[model samples]
Target: MQEFEPATDQLDEAWDAIQHVADLQDAWAAINPQGEQQRLDDQLDRNLVQDSDDEFAEMEVPELQSRQNIHQGDQPRCAIETCDPEITEEQAQHMMRQLNEKQRQVFNHVSKWCDDKARDQSVDPFQMFLTGGAGTGKSHVIKCIQYYAKKVFARMTESAEDMTVLSLAHLGTAAFNICGQTICSGLKINPKSQKEYKPLGEESLNTLRVKYRHLQLVIIDEISMVSTTQLTYIFGRLQQIKGTYTDFGNVSILAVGDFYQLPPISPPTPLCFPHDEILKDIWNPLFQIVELKEIMRQKDDAIFAQMLNRLRERKKKQPLQKTDKELLESRRVEENNLTAPPDALHLFYLNKDVDSHNERKLASLNTEMFTIKANDVDQRGGRIIQVHETPHRTTRADDTSLASYLKLAVDARVMLIANVDVSDGLCNGVPGIVKGIEFCNSQNMPIVVYVKFDSDRVGAKTRTTQFIPPHYAGCVPIKPRKESFKVRGRTFTTTREQMPLKLAWAVTVHKVQGQTTDQAVISMKGLRKSMAYVALSRVTHLEGMYLMDYDESRIFCNEDIEANVAKMPTCDLSKANPLTEIDHNTNFVIAHHNIQSLHRHIDDLKRTQK
Candidate 1:
């Protein structure tokens, strides 16, 4: 090429032409879908799906994938994903046969409703609040409904694989007791913002509809713990998911709980405390109450049962009878002498006291102390922003009770914070003794902790592990729990990997709400009267219950709750004939009846028209 000097104007024109062409290409790329896709592909190839980890981004990681799987219906919401082999048809039938007359009536009513639902009969959804005291065979009825009614639904639907029923509770421990899942987990609710529940995405809704297409019944265990606002959210969410405007999407609900126990947490009032007239209207029509009487737990001791019943509704200012005072005083034990029953569970009103007792008990044990830390990852908008090598110590964050750090010894007592297996009684709040620790080959961190559970049922199956003592037959190997929790004063969420266990020398009254212990030494110091009732009711018999301080002053139920409960209807055996009665006020006639009565009721309606 010949080197030639061009004019200044010509050179400037050529440079501008090149710049214009470059700008045109940039604009085309900005609008081109293919170009945008290519950019995404490149970003995904480098495992960097986000431009910034701190900001919101589309995630393709396994963690996010797993969460999506749950939303997509590939995973179950309740702990009863796999049916327990022990809950057989024969066993369920046998239990039903043994039910009391009142329990039998509930079973019959629910079973008939499930049958009607399966048959696609045009009827209103079944809604009932099964209320009872501490022990009125409510749990027994729940078992019967779960094991027996499921068969009816499966058989009628002609699909054994179809999910027909779900059991849910407000609290994790309560749900565990029922072999179910927490309401938030089962309903895909964001526990942090329960009152402000938003509708699920289209994809999630579609998947849930498919998953629960055959679902006819839902059993809510701790109904008392469910707040009015949360209850509304549940109803709205169900309606949205089922694509129906009807109450609870026409799904049958058997809400079982004792309102006399622990009420809903503050900021949200109890179901009885309807905030508005609209809510009150919805509440009255939504649920038909069935108050269960007859205390089954203390049936052997009728006197004690009567005493508990009397005390259940006792007013705050009411004086305890001399006999009641004498009985309670007889079980009083000095606070300093709690160690006499070395194995008895000590119940405290505060977590701090529980922690103090556990720490002191752990320190008293003569063994090597192992400080195990959790692997916590702080994430915001689907991307992990930071990793906490030594996480801040917290007893609870969100739903995960697993602490950031756990201190243990070989013989230190521990309690499960999660339900390892409910049917085997290896549920939350279960006590055990540390047998041994198995460390990972790559790190000093413990991979599994062997625990000798108090109940033989927990570790009945022999586990062939080298880490546990060869002589020990009831050792269960507990692995690290992986859960996400919201950190305080932080915008991001933290995913923690730690053992689902905590010191068990002492436990809080809140933890033992729906549980029963063989023997317990309870401290009612500084606790509300409602809390005192819950703590006292945990022991089946008065002989097994020991009070640190018998403060009868703090032993009464809420007066308003009592009045509300009194208005609730009890099951009448004479009226158990199903569909025999109809509401005269509503535009639609509501009926409660079995198959035989359905036709007769329709005939009666025809006769009345004449």
Candidate 2:
């Protein structure tokens, strides 16, 4: 240690304080920003930082701007000065007047909240957690806000700077439906990594810094499927890349999902408020919470909506009325009606069952099966397609057995798994038939499959997708769903790719969430729990629901299957021996009381015939 240069009398105390400040600045200056940020981010992932305001104030950190500091990416959106809202309260009310009373209320609440955020200088942008049951217009409200925000920003400035108001989803189908990027792609996750908690590497952090430099608002749809650990990283990494010490770095986060729905397959983590400490920390600060009660999809059928609400909440069921029980029973397609053109959409509880059923159906059709092995290669250009087999746990593509290869016959009932073009109605769950295929050359390797969506779905037009293989290195424009999970003390990655089409003759209930079917035959054999209710709710009307070999007990999901893993951050910080087994079992639940509105209000539910 260097000998201290003493100041005269009381000046020594002041000299020591000044020396400490210089030392702190020098310490920060010595470290690389990117590495320091990553270290801090990882620290956030593993600890609940308990710094007092005064402690942080004493640090020699650079002062961050209240707004417009999230990112400037390659594209700069509107300047903060020019992005003020012009929507008057009257205009907002007028725009939402077409919605139902409940919808209008939620819309107005979110509209005004977003409006204030657009003009306010509180540092944090607009954020929300919009939750609701199926058909509650969660998606509708998101779209409305997206449209309104654009108009407000446009009216403020003439220059279009690619002001991004984007939607992000945990899965490819959801992202595609919203015309947005997947969380994995946006955040820079190494899909091939064998680690469950893949933090953002420098490359990923830098990429996010550039790509989303101008990112405005982020809407995470289907939040239930995203694990808490995954979300923790998203929050922490975004803050790190944006260089803001504030929560979410002053960027807005609109999280939309129903916990009653299925959670992410691996780790099977469903985000619950307050209970999940890490998620709670990420959600700290100003976020408008909105739960839409009215069922916009089933607006005319108050009874159906009530039943769904009760079922979704897992409430103790009241004795079924004789007529109500008969109504559900009568809707079950007997052998005579089962084979009709408007066949019930088959819902299977197991992946194997769905695969075997669809395969058998296609085999029985007496058509030639075309097989296309996926084109997979390592970074060195060596083919890892078959050479390096990844141990599979459970994922959307793994369950289908199409990540490596896809086999299909013409005229098979199918569902478009990826969005080909939303404008023309090429979207997930649009039940259709595979009309034919076009091969690459005379050698007859498959290229594109022509599909004709149901007239009721796409207004009678053919949609075509060029068969693209998954570049494990992610070379192609199309990014397949990357499913990560843990098995036997290591993280493993599995990519599901090639066929954007899945057999529609039978689909898993989780696959069919956020969809409506005129008729559905839900088989409840071997269900984990409460998923039967989810399957049953897909039918637009009660009369269209069919149950095959169903049991009432299995209709409620198997609550025992839910994983009770300790919080990841806490686990990482603990001193004791860590959990050797990380169970990625697929179990889910929303242990909340029934919605009060389920007790139908005669006045509130009176339907108007349009």
The best candidate by lDDT is 1
Off by over 4 Å in 2: 1-95, 155-161, 190-207, 273-288, 316-324, 334-342, 364-366, 371-405, 415-432, 440-444, 452-501, 557-610
lDDT of each: 0.65, 0.52
Q: TM-score of each candidate?
A: 0.74, 0.62
Q: Model 2, 1-610: lDDT tens per residue?
A: 1347454555756744664455442355367655754655444333211111101121111100000111213111101111112356555434444466555555555555556665764634656667778878776666666666555544434356555566677654455445455565555532222323444667546756766665557878888777655676677666876788766766778788776676655446455534344425444344445567778767788888777776665533445555545555665555335442233456776667677767777777778887655433221111133323332333332223234555767767665554344334444444556666667553223555655444322422331233334321111122233221122232222233355556656676666665566666677777555577667776767666667764555645324222321121210111111121223364544254866764453332232111
Cα lDDT for residue 128, candidate 2 = 63
RMSD (CA, Å), candidate 2 to true, equals: 19.4
lDDT of 1 by residue, 1-610 (tens): 1356657678757855764455443455579856644543333233211111011111110000000011222221111112243576556656776677677778778776666666765656778889888878788889888986677777755567677788887654466567676665566654443444456655556767777887778899878777665677678768887888888988888899888887765333457654563333345556778878889978887877888887888899999888887888778787325343554677776667777877887888888888888888987546677887688564332435566778988888776766455445555555667878778773446888888765445545435424456665568888887766676655456888888787767766655666665577888787675777777777778887888866888788877887665565554433444433555555764455656756534643443331
Q: Give the Å error, residue 436, model 2.
A: 2.8
